[model samples]
Target chain A: MTAVAAFAWSVLQDALHRKVFYAILAFSLLLMLLIPMLPSASVGVQVDLLREAALGLTSIMAFLLAVIMASTIIPGELGRRTLYNTLSRPVRRWQYYLGKFIGIMAVVAIALLVSLVVLLILVGAKFGTFNPGLAKAIFTIFLEAMVLASVAMLASVYLSPLVCILLAGLFYVACHVKGDFLYRAMTDSTNHALLRGLSGFLYYILPNLERMNINETIAHSERVFRVGAGELVLLSAIALVFSAIFIALGAYLFERRDL
Target chain B: MEAVLSVEELHKAYRTRLGGPRRQALSGLSFTVPRNSVVGLLGPNGAGKTTTLKCVMGLVRPDAGKVSLFGRDGDAVEARRRVGFLPEQPYFDLYLTPRKLLHYYGRLSGMGASSARSRISYLLNLVGMEDDADLTMDKFSKGMLQRIGLAQALLAEPELLILDEPSSGLDPLGKLEMRDVLKSLGTGGTTILLSSHQLSEIEEICDRVIIIHRGREVASGRLDELLEEKGDCEVLLAEPAPGATSGLPSSASWAEDSGGKRLTVSREELSAALTALIESGASIAEVRSRRLSLEEFFVRRIGKTGWEVEE
Candidate 1:
């Protein structure tokens, strides 16, 4: 456990020093700050639109942070040959793998926290009100990003960073639309039997990431349907389970790999 | 005597690329490091020295045999706890200072904060990096990094140290300092297994050597014993008298001179050669069995044709 924590701390320190991490954070905050200048739909719903836009920007920021860090950390260490120092110690491969994953999560968490504060200040200065419920949406965004990062990290153990990013992106899109597009494809008689079978198989295997996108709901002050505490807990559990599975499999493969 | 580390019949093969044929890196390699002794692993390029060290450290798995550290399986965590390793040309994160990096490794090695601090201080001073301990490694030279690598490997005060090319990238002065450090460690009762291409360095510091060619052990013994020319004696003379050549035995042959004339003969004919020199009124200088330098011994065993062609 100490070994894992040490590696995680090293990752956190290393990530903080990188220029790319700051570049992504600054770009997203700049976009969020520019949200108020867009064309308005109505005077009453302008604040809601601004919150939705801010949340959308935040989601992109979190996803980029997670996927980029998870995809590059292991491969970068291996390429630099720094991993030989750490892995040669009295530490297990699983500890190193888990620590790196945790470190990526820590970076994502810090980035999201900073972005959330920026979003709150922007909303307060522009609209003269506080939307405390925004925390719920941000929490869901973090959960969703963890899932994405885990899957990307698993792919990173076997593929390059660019390929892992692409695969994770494809996975995100497929999983997000599974509840809607996959259902339609599975039930539509116009589709071929093999296509329907494949769709059904994918829908059953992949998580419904679309359910975790409650940005609009919380951004609009829960005017339609609110995310209750019980639902949030259930959703978090599901994401945690999936992330564990991905991490376990990734560690297993990493352990067997010759360094 | 118990061996601190032993490798028996180890074998490994690596694929050049995807779908490529496997190339043998180690073929039935075997050697052992006696407790508290410094043993050099000597080889030319592609002799599997690095592969053998990697296998001993559990970084790579051997296909055929076993490596035991302190009489336990090499891959066991408990066995590795007593070991330290420095890889060839090790790299570290540039943003970290040596102090911070050593602290991190110390924690992983299960050292408490106070003990780790003292050990880190001692090692930094020992490796001559005390002044630059707090500086980030981004601007460090190759030799500076090598020193830090040694410091990190010594952080936990391991019982056994395995170093690959420790003198690599060092200047003459730095290489001398490294030799002194390794010699002191061996005297302090730490077992060492060193892999190097520098035959002189090995000859200077190692008590014994394991010479490998084509991933197999060709010779293993005390350095002096391995370099001794069997059944051969060298005789030296100050000056030869007239007709001294006819008085010599048929087995005697003239050898090279370094400010003195020398001759090589069978060990059995040393007495006859000396008597012949005396009878001819030629002053006798020194007589001893012939011995080759480490370089000559290596070439003699490996041959003029490189191991690459043979492999």
Candidate 2:
């Protein structure tokens, strides 16, 4: 556990020094600050639009931070030969993998929290109301980012960062669209048997990432339906299960990989 | 002697990119480092020295065979707890100061914060980086990084130290200091398995050497035993004598240096050569069996063909 924490701390320190990390964070913050510049709408609808846009920006920031950090940390360490020093110690490979993943999430969480605070302040000053409900959307964004990070990190074990990023992007798109496209393709009698079978397998296997996106609902003050505690717990469970599977598989592959 | 580390029948092959043929990195390589012994792992480029070290360190998985550390399975984290390693050209995140980096590694090695703090200070001084300990490593030279690498490897006060090219990238003075440090550690009973291309450094510090070629062991043993050339004797004169070779046998060859005149002859001709020297009025200083230098021994073992091919 000490080794794991140390590795996690090292990743945090490493990420703090990376220009890309700050670049992404700064860019997201800059966009959020510019939210007031959007064309003026009615007083009520304008605030909702601002909240929605701000939450969307926060999600993108959190996801980008998680995926980029996860995708680059391992390969960068390997390329720099720093893994030789760290892994040569009395630490297990799984501990290192878990620590790095946790570190990536920690960074993403910090980024999300900062965005949440900024969004709250912006809404309070601009519209005279603190929509603290935005926290729900940010929390879900974090959960979804956890899944994306795990997937990116798993691919990072065998693929370059560019390839890993591209693959994770494709995975994100597929998981979000699978609920509609895949379900239709699976039941369409016009499709071939093998294609339908694959679609069915994918539809069942891949988590419905779209379900995790409550940004619009929360941003609009949950006018349609409240995101209950039960739903949050279920979302947490799904995210945890998928992240565990990807991370476990990644650790297994990393164990047998040559440094 | 009890062995601190042992590898048996280790084999590793790396697949070429794009599904090309596999390149054998280690082929049934085997050796043991006895407790408190400093053994040099010497090999040419692509001779699997690094791969063998990585296998023992658990950084690389062997295709077949076993590595045991402290008489336990090498894969066990406990087995590596007593070991420290400095890989060739050790690297670290440049943003970390030496103190921070060592603290991090010290934690990884299971050292408490307070103990690690003191140990870090001691090591920074020992490696002559105390003044620069707080500075980020980005500005550090390769030699400085190597020093920090050694410091981290020693942070745990490990029973065994495995170093790959420990003196790599160091200036002449740095190399000498590193040699002295390693020599002291060896004398203090820290077992070390050092892999290096610097034969001179190995000769100066290692008590024994294991030379490998083409992923196989060519020769290995104590330095004196391996370098000893049987059936050969060298006689040294007390002073330079141009006339020393006047009555020497045709098989005897003599060279002059600041020390004196030195003659090398086959064991069969030693008596005749000494008699000739005595009759020629040469003052004898010493007479002993001739021993090859480490470089000569390595060349002989690895062969000229191996040399040309590596080049």
Candidate 3:
């Protein structure tokens, strides 16, 4: 096999040696259990509940997985001095970082898909309808999770794991309402062109969580889904570009560091 | 033998907790190890031996100067394929047995699945770990872990082998066995570079020695040549009369001996003393000059301050 393929396999195998897979299983069970315990007054409230629950489940699990995984990758390798062993191989420093990125992303994707499947089954049992749109929304959640994971990895590579976890968690929470923060600033009458441009800068910097979110639309049929294929494609490209840049930065810092 | 590994003017440093500038760990250190030779890197604690190895492996980039392997520049990925490093206190997953661990590392070295599978058993046997190959690495003792680590380093059949404190936690017999093993590996045309504080251990296996203290290489060369250059050697008397002890050279004063027959002495008076003793009625069963062990010779050169350098 090629070096890149071998590196990817190594990263995946190392990750599995930890109980990362088991923890994901436990969380999936929790999500399944929550399906029958919905506190809803009416059918509309119930579907809204399921939609919120499913989206929240996928989002929360993805967030936790990324934070947990990214928090450990660099620090654990350094702590064990395994980073030295791995880097001593013929693989490039960038390949080491990118392989880790891909491995963690693959695990997150699997967890997201599995959680979506379980939630869909519950939804099918309760309402006699399995919403394909929910499945689609879960896919977007995985995409957003990839963005969040990249951000987390970038922070972890530069800062202590604690600081990385806090910063990444804060961004994950704040980005969910990033659109509202920008809109509030944009509509304020007091703002001039310069302030508006700065606000716009901040807006574009934080991921537009609203664009990728198809959760609320699935619940309220009147809310038109405005996302186009072009937007999804663009957003994915943006996430990937950001991730690559972040990973490059990580590799550069790691290269300069004395294990 | 060509210099398979050369470190020139290397430097590194760490920042203190109290907002300070970089504190240099390595200070213009330089040396060369001939190919296919087992060289001992000797130093006390905090002597920068580990730092040197890390720099050579590119785990820690030097702030200044260069480290080269196989004529290529340091930190070059291409150079790494020919190198294998066993860090101090190597930790694999506690859950992985030697069988699994070797296979895992082989794959990382870019071997195919079938190849890795085939090489696993072979590497395990090479380390004398064939019996415990099926046991978890964590369950094995420190000596076993080190042996398995050796296997991993050798899995790629590297041209240059760098090991740091490889026998730090072995029993006397284990150490002896390990030295023999390393000697055998050296014979196979793999240049081995290792660091340790055990003077006897290094003396036993190394063809050459490099002594580093506080990040600077104080001495390095062929073992016998280093002793000669540094003014440390022993005088072995044949069957000199008991009264001859009083006639010993001042510099050649009696030193801590092995058996009653073995005695250490200074370099200057060794020839004259041996000639005079032979001329006398002392029946020369065996008369030979003894060089100081690598440890004592290293200590004599460094003056025993224990790796302290000012700036």
Candidate 4:
């Protein structure tokens, strides 16, 4: 555990210490600071519009950062041959996979918090009140980022970087598509049972992004009441467990790989 | 010494759906590296030198073989704590300086913080890179990278050092220096298995050489034995005074290899003619033998020796 912590810390330092991360943070802050200008453009929509815009920025920022960092972690280590140094040790395959996952998660968490703080400062100045929905959205995006990162890493283990990125991007879109895969699976007659079975399984298995979309949280309270907190928790936990399972599978595949 | 590394009928095959049938990377490859000796794993390209090392290091698994190190099953993670490896194209984080690289490897090798710190310093100086410890790897030359690589391999002061072509990119001087490092490691009771096709380079450092041909051991023994059985002859050619190919004991059956500049004698006549040529007032200008270089041995035995290899 200590060794994993040390490894995780090293990775975290690399992610947070680089110039590019600070640049991204500053860019996110600038975007948040621009929210006040929305009030100048509209008299009544200022509160609703500014809040929705911040949530949208945070969600996109968190997800984009997740994908970008996920795409780089394994490829970057391989590019530098750093994976050899780590794997050549007495460390287990799972430790390396978990360590990298935790490291990336920590970085994403920190990035989310930073962006959240900036959003809060803007919200406080405009409305003089804190929205609980904002916190929920921020934290939910953090979980969503973990899921995306894991799926991306799973693709990375066996697939090429370009292909892994493409696949993970497809997964994100698929997760948001609601009924596309499930509906197609049910309507097909050839292997209809198998397809429907798989699709039915995925209906609850995937993150229902259309439901969790934080944009609706700020726009109207009526939309937020329909969703239960337990569902989101259960779904996020399932996603995290699935991510863990995928990482473990990826580690096994990687352990046997020649590199 | 017991075998520090043991592999019995190790095999690794990859079934790629891309094109042809599944290719076997290793089949029926078996060899034991005795402890505390500098052993050179010599083979032609694709002779499974790297495959064998990977098997020993647990990087590549054989389908039907077992690799035991320090008498422990290869699956034992602690066994790796006692093994150090230098991959053929080793890489490190470009942003990390030599100091950081050593620190990172040292940490992974199970060294404690203080021990890692002191050992890092010791290794940096041991490889003669203490001066450039602060420089990032991106700025390092190939030779420097190799030296640092060597240092990292020794970071844990492992009992077995598996180096894959450690001298490939080294200049003559670098090779000599690396040669000294491996020799000292052998002296210090570290079992070193280095793989390379540079026969001369391997010959210079390793006490015993194992030649694997087409994924099987073709020859294994001391260098002298391998060269000796090839039936080599050494000649002490004496310079007979100008125009005196005639000072020759006419009884000596010899052919002038390069228009009388040098005389070539068959293997049996080397001793007898060494005495006669000197007694005939000819001063031996050079006394050298054609000890089979590793390259020549590989070509003769593996490449064209026509040995009925089962592999």
Candidate 5:
């Protein structure tokens, strides 16, 4: 456990040194602050509009950070031969793999927290009200990003970073649309057996990422669909189980491959 | 002597390209590194030295045979806890300072904070990087990185040390310092298995060498014994009479030396060459069996054709 923590700490320190990390955060915050100046934003419910735009910016920032870090950390270390020293120790390959996954999560969590704080300050100053309810949206974004990061990391062991990113993007779209699109494809009487079989397979295997997108629900002032604590707990359970499966599979494959 | 590490009939094959035929990297390779001795692993580029070390470190899985470390399987984490390895041209994250980097590795090696701190200090000073220990390694030269690599390898105070191309990027003075450090470590009872292309470095620091060619052990023994010529003798002559040229044996090869002219001949032709020199009234300066340098011995054993092919 100490070995895993040490590796995780190293990843945090290494990520802090990269300019891209700060660049993405700064760019997202800058864009968020500029949202109120838009001409169309003033015509509607201003506070709701501001909240929606800010949450959208924060989600994009968190997703980019999670996917990029998860995709590159392993392959970059392998390319630089830095892993030889780390893996040559008494530490097991599983520890290194798990530690890196946890590290990526930690970074994503920090980025989301910082973005949340900025959004809160902007809302308080613009609307003269402190709405703590925004935590629900931020938490769901975290859960969704965790799922994406795990998939990206699993792909990274066998594919390059660019390919991993592309695959993760495709997976996000497939998983989001599978709940609706694949259901129709699977049940339609006109569909061929092979096509139905493939859709069935994908629908059962891929995690439902769309369920975690509660941005609009929390952004609107009217609680049309309130995100209750029970829903959050169930979502957390699903995301944790799905991420654990990907991590375990990734670790198993990494252990067998020659470094 | 007890053996610290032993490899038996190890074999590994790597695919040249995806879905292509496998190329043999190690074929029935076997050797043992004795405890408390600095053993050199000498071979050309494609001779599988790195592959052998990787197998011992459990980085690469061998297709056949076994590696035992102090009576345990090489792949066991317990066995690896007592071993330290430095890869060829080691690289570290440039964002980390030497202190931070060693601390991270020390923690991975299971050292406590206080002990890891002390060990980091000792290793930094040992590798002559204590002055720049806190500076980020972004601008460090290759030699500086090599020093830090050595420091990290020693962070665990391992009983056995394996180094690949330890002197690959060092200057003359840095190489000398590295040799001195290694010699001190050998004296302090750390068994070392070194792989290098610098024959002189091996000749100076190693007591024994295992020479492998084409992934098989071609020679393994004490250094001096291996360099001794079996059936050759060298005869040196001082100033001689003008007619001495006519009396010299045709089978002898002549090469001029700073002291005088020297003739190299086989054991059977040594007596005839001496008698010819004596009859010609030339003074016999010295007579001894030909001594081959490590470089000369390596070329003779591996052949010039093999060397060119490796190049």
Candidate 6:
């Protein structure tokens, strides 16, 4: 556990030194601050618009931070020969893998927290009302980012960062679309049998990432259906199970890999 | 003597590319580093020296055979806890200060915070980087980085220190300092296995050597014993007498240096060469069996042909 914490702390230190980390973070905050400029349908929907846009920007910030950090950390360390120093220590491969994953999430979580605070201030200052409900949407965004980061990290073990990012992007799109597009493709009679079979297989295997997206509902004050603690627990469970599978597979491959 | 590390019939092959032909890096290569011995791992380019070290360090998995450290499996975390390694041209995050970097490694090695702080300070001074310990390594020279690398390797005061090209990137003085440090460590009972192309460095610091050619052990033994086995003799003369070579055995060769004119002869021609030198009025100052230098021994064992092949 000490070794794991050391590795995790090292990753955070490494990230803190990189310029890209700050750039992504600053850019996300700057954009979120500009959410008031976006046109809205009416004066009544203006607050909802601000919350929705800010949360949307926050999700992008979280995902970008998560995937980019995950994709680059392993490959960067390996290319720089720094992994030789770390892994040569008396630590297990799983510890290094898990530590790095946790570090990436930490960075993403930090970014999300900053965005939440900024959005909260913006809501209070503009509408003269406290909207702590934004925290709930930020939590779900964090869970989705967790899944994205794990997938990217798994790909990063064997693929280059660019390829890992692209693959994760494709995964995000496919998983998000699967809940609707894949289900329809599986049942649409116009599609070929093989296509339907493939869609059905993918639908069953891929996590429903869109289920974690509640920005619109939360931004509009959750009037239609309240997101209770039970629902949040279920989302957390889904993200953990999927992330665990990818992380386990990555660590197994990394254990057998030659540094 | 107890062996701190032993490898047996280790084999490793790396694919050049996906589905490409595998290049053999190690083929049934085996050796052992006895406790408290400074053993040099000498080999030509691409002779699997790095691969062997990587295998022992568990950075690269061997396809066959076993590596044992302290009579236990080399891959065991507990066994590795007692070992420290400096890879060939070790690198680290440039933004980290030498102190911070050592602290991180010390933590990974499971050192207590206070012990690690004291150890880091001692290592920084040992590597002559104490003044620069607080600065980021971004502007450090290659030699400075090498020193930091060595410092990190010694951070835990490990029992077995495995270094690949430990003197690399150091200036002559730095190299000498590194040699002294390693020599002192060996005297203090650290089992070191170092791989280096600098044969002279190995010759000076190592008591034994393992020379590999094309991924197989070509020779291995005590340095003095290996050199003495050639049975060559050298006779030092008191003066540079040009006539010292007159009527000497055909096998005897003469050369003049600052000390005097010397004659080197095979064991069979030693008496005849000495008699010839006496008849020529050459004043003999000393006579002794010749010992081959590490370079000469390496060349003789590996052969010119083995030297020519890059791999």
Candidate 3: which stretches are off by over 4 Å? A14-17, A186-201, A219-223, A226-228, B229-240, B245-252, B261-280, B304-311
What lDDT score goes with residue A50 in model 5? 89
DockQ of 3: 0.67
Question: What lDDT tens digits, residue by residue, belong to model 5 across residues A1-259?
Answer: 9988887887788889999999999999999999988775454578888899899999889989999999999999999999999998988999999999888889889999998999999999988889888988999899999999999999999799999999989999998999999988998979999999999999999989889888888889537998899999999999999999999999999988787
Tens digit of per-residue lDDT, candidate 3, span B152-186? 88888889999988887777777877788788889
Of the native A-B interface contacts, what share survives in model 1? 0.77
Would candidate 2 be rated incorrect, acceptable, medium or high by CAPRI criteria?
high
- Alpha-carbon interface RMSD for all candidates, in angstroms: 0.9, 0.7, 1.9, 2.0, 0.7, 0.6
True contacts kept of each: 0.77, 0.93, 0.77, 0.57, 0.87, 0.97
lDDT per residue, candidate 1, B147-235, as tens digits? 99999888888899999999999999999999999999999999999999999999998989999888889999888898899899988
Model 6 chain B: ten consecutive residues of lowest lDDT? B302-311
Number of the top-ranking candidate, with DockQ as the measure: 6
lDDT of 5 by residue, B1-311 (tens): 89889999999888877877777788899999999989999988888899999999988889998999987999888889999999999999988899999988888898899999998999889989999999999999999999999999888998999999999899999999999999999999999999999999999999889998877888898888898787888888767445556566666887776767778888888888888878888788889888788998888777743421211
Q: Please, what are the lDDT tens digits per residue for candidate 2 over residues B32-146?
A: 9999999999988989999999999999999999999999999899989899999999999898899999989989889999999988999999999999999999999999999
Better of 3 and 6 by lDDT: 6
Query: Which lDDT tens digits does candidate 2 get at residues A8-86?
Result: 8877887888888889989999999898998879876988898899889988888888988899989999999999999
User: CA lDDT of A109 in candidate 4?
Assistant: 89
Q: Candidates' lDDT values, in order?
A: 0.90, 0.91, 0.75, 0.75, 0.89, 0.91
Which ten-residue region of model 4 chain A has the weakest summed lDDT? A218-227
After superposition, the stretches of candidate 2 with alpha carbons farther than 4 Å from their true spots are: B304-311
Candidate 4 regions with alpha-carbon error over 4 angstroms: A17-24, A39-45, A179-198, A209-215, A218-236, B14-17, B21-24, B230-291, B305-311
lDDT per residue (tens digit) for residues A213-256 in model 6: 99999999999979889999999999999999999999999999
Native contacts retained by candidate 5: 0.87
Q: How many residue pairs collide in each prediction?
A: 0, 0, 2, 1, 0, 0
What does the TM-score come to for chain B in model 4? 0.82
Clash-forming residue pairs, model 5: none
